[model samples]
Target: MTIKLLAIGKTDNKLLASLITDYQNRLGHYIKFEFEIIPDLKKVKHLSETQQKEKEGALILSKLAATDTLILLDEKGKQMHSIAFSEYLQKYMNSGIKQLVFVIGGPYGFSEAVYNKAQGMLSLSKMTFSHQMIRLFIVEQFYRAFTILKNEPYHHR
Candidate 1:
């Protein structure tokens, strides 16, 4: 199965971008992984929070295909250990999922329509992290999970 990460906005911090790239490269060794950035909303100063989220949600939804299994990185979602996450991915692959897409919403989070379209939601942690940082973290975790599944030295139990 192919794993895709879709997030809102760019990672402006050079250091963070480098780290995200590093993980992305490592993850490529184990799976077909792709990270796509959805540009930030324009003229946000005039739009209400709800309006901004609605606009962003539409853009996010538009990037998806009808066959894609949409998952959201939501704070209230399920939290799993690295090993378990690997197993979860294994199950998806076993079930023959073509593409698994995980999305990180914009500043005010996803709109109701986006939430409704998601098949599942996952949380990296209970504490909050910047959306850009979360992208890096999730990429790294995907790499670690694959390493764990393969019994590679990259991940230690």
Candidate 2:
């Protein structure tokens, strides 16, 4: 299955962007991976948090296909070990899915609609992370997962 990572905004920090790019390139060697940055919403000062979430949710939904399996990277989601995550990837690959999309929502988190649309949710950590930093972490973990799957030395027990 093709894996797609959809995040709410662009990575503004140059160092984070470079690290994300590095992992993206490494991931491509193992599987079809795509990283898409949805532009940040404008005029946020005028909109309430709920309104921003609603608008962002709409944009997130617009990128999804009817058949795509949507997964959200949420704080309240299931947390798993690296080996388990690699197994999760194997499960999707075995399911005959065309695309597996994981989304990182805006600053305030995902809206109710976005939550309802998701097939599953995953948490990277219990601690909070910046949206830009999460992008790098997820991509790197994805690369690590693939390496583990291939019995490579990049990931250790």
Candidate 3:
């Protein structure tokens, strides 16, 4: 299955962008991966948090394919260790999905509609992380998970 990561907004930090690129390149060897960045909403000062979430939610939904399996990287989602996460990836690959999309929502988080559309949710950590940083973290984890699955030395117990 092809894996896609959809995140709202651009990564402004040069260092973070480079790191994300590095991991993206590494992840490509194991699976088809695409990282799509939705442009940040403009004039956010005029919109309330709810309005922003609703607008962002619509944009997020627009990027999804009807048959895609959506998974949100949410704070309240299920948290798993590295090995378990690797197993989760194995399960998804075995499920014969067309595409697996993992989304990192806007600053305020996902709207109810986005939540309802998701097949599942995953939490990388209990602690909060910036949206840009999460991109790198998730990509790196994808690489690590693949390495683990292949019995490579890139990941250790």
Q: Report the Cα lDDT for candidate 1.
A: 0.94
lDDT of 3 by residue, 1-157 (tens): 9999999999999999999999999888999999999999999999999999999999999999999999999999999988899999999999999999999999999999999999999999999999999999999999999999999999878
Query: After superposition, which runs of candidate 1 have C-alpha atoms over 4 Å from their true positions?
Result: none
For residues 36-117, write the lDDT of model 1, one tens digit per residue: 9999988899999999999999999999999999989999899999999999888888888899999999989999999999
Per-model TM-score versus the true fold: 0.98, 0.99, 0.98
Clashing pairs in 2: none
Q: For model 3, what is the alpha-carbon lDDT of residue 75?
A: 96
Cα lDDT of model 2 by residue, 66-137, tens digit? 999999999999999999999999999999999999999999999899999999999999999999999999
Ranking by lDDT: 2, 3, 1
List the global CA lDDT of all models.
0.94, 0.96, 0.96
Q: How much is the lDDT of residue 57 in candidate 3?
A: 99
- True-vs-predicted CA distance for residue 142, candidate 3, Å: 0.3
